[model samples]
Target chain A: MIDKQVRTVAEALEGLQDGAAIMISGFGEAGVPAELIDGVVAQGACDLTIISNNAGTGDVGIAALIGAGRVRKVICSYPRMVGSRHFEERYRAGELELELVPQGNLAARIQAAGSGLGAIFTPTGYGTKLAEGKETREIDGRQYVLEYPIQADVALVKAYKADRWGNLVYRKAARNFGPIMAMAGKTTIVQVEDIDPLGTLDPETVVTPGIFVDRIVRIADAGKAAA
Target chain B: MSAADTIQRLDKQQLARRVARDIPEGAYVNLGIGLPTQVANYLDTAGDYFLHSENGILGMGPAPDEDHIDWDLINAGKQPVTLLNGGCFFHHGDSFSMMRGGHIDICVMGAYQVSTRGDLANWHTGDPDAIPAVGGAMDLAIGAKQVFVMMNLLTKTGESKLVEHCTYPLTGLGCVSRIYSELGVIDLGPDGAKVVEMVDNLTLEHLREMTGVDLTMAQ
Candidate 1:
């Protein structure tokens, strides 16, 4: 196990390869791992498939990858709001692929993948254009739609604090996609603002246990740092 | 109704009943996670008007059976929601496309502010410590053919939420076509906004007095 913490975003991204299906945790800008996203951009990783809720505007998060010309497919629900003009141009020019998911279903898919469930049935958008070509089954005289699993090679999550054992605790909306993706990824990396000693974290507060986290990277306070 | 008789006196639930009256037979709608979600209780969706919860379940009729709620099948806000007969679940990716891709017919949502230009501001109150979660509001606001807003005219601070321009963050720009308030229904148009319907006893002056922006009623 890589029990070490990386010093730089570049060092933190050393394990990610091109074409990797990476799941990023965030809702708008709240829970996004700003440092990790900056690292992905700085590392110049390309041809990536990013799974996220919404692309934090073009200058941040998955949008940076979209800007770096590194992203291939985006499995997200909303792109136009955040993706910059460059992203829009790419999407319209066929430079990028978009896989839209409902916000709730996106969370569930991530959770479902994490929970080891093969699939689930929801009637969210059925009998409309969204149901095009999907396999439909009748359960109890009502039609339920089936959605498959969502797994990825790596997942980047931001947590407020983490213990040396890699247990994580998130503050606010940052917690939404983090824990779910932790279980869904082959290698889950956490970027946290604070790192504490092992056993220091209250057991009840452990949002993502060490078993789900493969690595830890601590971020020095970016806002207060001297230029 | 004139702009004068905009909002007389009504509560959010009362407004929900007015919104419920508009549910057409067999139309599909996704009630946004917050106050707009209360509309589900007033509509008769037993067999029609499929209610969709952004968290990925349809055939939605009302809140989950209080006696048998399932946390796993909750909506975007993690509130327990129930499925009507024939309801199913799918990958969230597909469901969002249905939203952004413009497959759903209507989406009832809550707004912090709606501009005369029809811009929608919701999901953020500018509190840095507050969670910035816009689950499916923007997608639903723009994707659905018709967007209905259910909101209080003023914030707790007593500021008018409807404005000439949005001072807060926006979920979508110029996406709303009409609005239903405790006062009445105001249709967004090219020349600012016009009051199309009002509560039985209010007037345009009363609406302007209680609103954050200038008011106009359709002649």
Candidate 2:
């Protein structure tokens, strides 16, 4: 059995270099690996390509990374949030690049990458500006646009629970993209609230198995002792 | 009174009520952000309907009490909401699959303009001044089995949102099936814009004059 447990955030993020393509899992504030991201910020890597659903809001999550000038480009569904001034300023000044993908297409592309498929045809984004410069075909009298896979060198994921083997179980809505990001990353590091004992989590309830996860770190609990 | 007179329009809650009355029982619905989110507060809980949020929530309920609000639980708009008894949450990818796989029965969204031929433009005005945030609008427009648009009939400058052709960038071509405005609701059928119903104190001719598009009253 592989022992993927690591003592701290730094050890989980070993070999992370500049200009790496990374997937930071989250939907708004939910499911964000804050400790791992803090490690990346502390490491001060630059010119990274980050993919997620939103471009981070306020001083939390990906906004902190953007504030550190770490992200050169962001491929996401929603780049503009209510108080996301960092990305807005950078984008307006042409200092940053944005790929505004439709939400469903974004997921399918990432899934295709993990499944070892070269590309996929999606009915979403057809006959819109998003379809521009992409190959489109009509299958069964319906229009579909061809989208490529989105693979990442590193993925920072968050989960509620993990056993010694790195199998994961998520907490409610916080499971947004962690499972899929685990599948698409070459190095999948997950931060969990608790590291359950071996066989503590039911086999059927495991959202992401141990094979997809590379390392596991237990984040310090806020206002309480670490689990 | 001349056509230039200030015609009273339905407020946000009233427009939401209008949209709520049209939802059928046992239908799985997706509500877009902004004004469309208000429709949830008006839905009859006695009916069997489920709300889907693109942010990975199904069976989404109305805004929760401030005391009971959970930060980890939110809708696509990032606002705190309640989850009904049958509510379940999943990954964002699976949420989009439910949206794109034609599992949604209806999707109600806000729009900048909707053409008579059922073309929709909501994401961007194509103006250099605006920031483009498309979100999940494109998926909802084409992927939902039926598309419903809810917005003012005219802009703040009084230009008709129901137009001969949309001036803004199209969100989806010929995807809108129904439009709900403050003044009236019109169906974009194969024939043309058919008037379904109207607010009190408005006429078919007035709606026609206001919209600048030919309006046929539905039988």
Candidate 3:
């Protein structure tokens, strides 16, 4: 029997270490694995490097973790938001480092890491400050900037449904970074609203396959809680 | 009344409607956050065009009513939005691929500054105290087939945003195709900035003095 289901958020985050590179999946409040993030906060891992689309919105989830002084750096496309005071304060106080990449380049770089690519040449950042330190080449007539993959030691993902084998499906826009992060993380932990029996989810609708996900924690009320 | 006394600029809604008029029917468009988002309102009555939100939605609709708000469904700006019939969602990788792959027909963005050569500078002001965030600005600037900018022609201090060259950090080079501003509409290309229209009672000479860049009248 191949089962990857875990009973609690603590068990799902077991063996986490300090100074780890973690990819927290979400775009704004949608699809954020808040429970797992809270577990990381409770687990007390320090010096974490987080990669996400946004830094954090309020004093919750990623914001709470950063507020707890757990994160040392953030690599994301957009970190400035309405309630992102913690990230701003930490950044201004010289306590946190930021690497701001354009959104397309950020997604492509993460995809490249999961696909086992050395690097990608994207037209998004060409002729801009984001491409300043990188190598550039003109393929045909269009210029492209070389961007490297962003790999993580662990990825925390939120999905709508999953099976014991860990095949996952997500809800609407909440699916933002879950699938890609699942592949890029060496040990991917997923918090799903429901864990179905074997062969329950139609294979055609599965977004992330079992091979990419390592552990699944069922948080039945996560959707309402996040709302 | 004197011509100067009669001069009037378009309001933000009027400017948005002006930009909306230029979008061809059935074009796939992405509107950047802030002022450019207003374009969607005018677009509703125009024709059938698909709205693309960078967070992974196509066929995106207007803001949902309070009762229908879903936290799981939101726009790139993180505002609650409705998904129209035939709408679909994907992950970040596929969403950005649709942008960088040149599948987006047009993108309307708000600008801090734009050069006569079509260079864009909206991501940052180089302020030392600011925490810079780029988001998807660069991608939409360069990736879309036609890039249209929506902004006020002048800063609050009365300086022109359309310049000979942008002083701020660049987002993309030679990417903008047109600019819709409070004062008028201008098209950018290899030739130079050409005036397509101007507000009533606004003269070419006064427009020239305000812009600081040489302008040619469109034939």
Best by TM-score: 3
lDDT string, candidate 2, A77-176, tens digits:
8887888888888888888889989888888889988779999999888888888988999999999999999999998999989998989998777888
TM-score of 1: 0.57
Question: Model 1 chain B, TM?
Answer: 0.88
Report the error of model 1 at residue A13, Å.
2.0
**DockQ-derived CAPRI band for the predicted complex in model 3:** medium
Q: Is candidate 2 or candidate 3 better by TM-score?
A: 3
Over B4-63, each residue of candidate 2 has an lDDT whose tens digit, in order, gives 456567899999999999998888999888898888778887887899988788888888
Off by over 4 Å in 2: A223-227, B3-8
Measured against the true structure, the TM-scores of the candidates, in listed sequence, are 0.57, 0.95, 0.97
The worst-scoring run of ten residues by lDDT in candidate 3 chain A lies at A218-227
What candidate 1 gets wrong by more than 4 Å, as runs, is: A1-4, A224-227, B1-219
The native-contact fraction of candidate 3 is: 0.90
Say which prediction, candidate 1 or candidate 2, comes out ahead on DockQ. Answer: 2
TM-score of the A-chain for all models = 0.91, 0.96, 0.97
Judged by DockQ, which candidate is best? 3
Compared with the true structure, what per-residue lDDT tens digits does model 1 show for residues B1-219? 555444365688898998888878787788876687888778864447777655445675455556665434456655555666677654344466667667888888888888988888775676654324445665576678788888777667767878998877676667787788877888885688889888777777877887857778877
lDDT of 3 by residue, B1-102 (tens): 656567789999999999988888889999999999989888755467899999999999999878788989999989999988888999999988888889
Clashes of each: 28, 0, 0
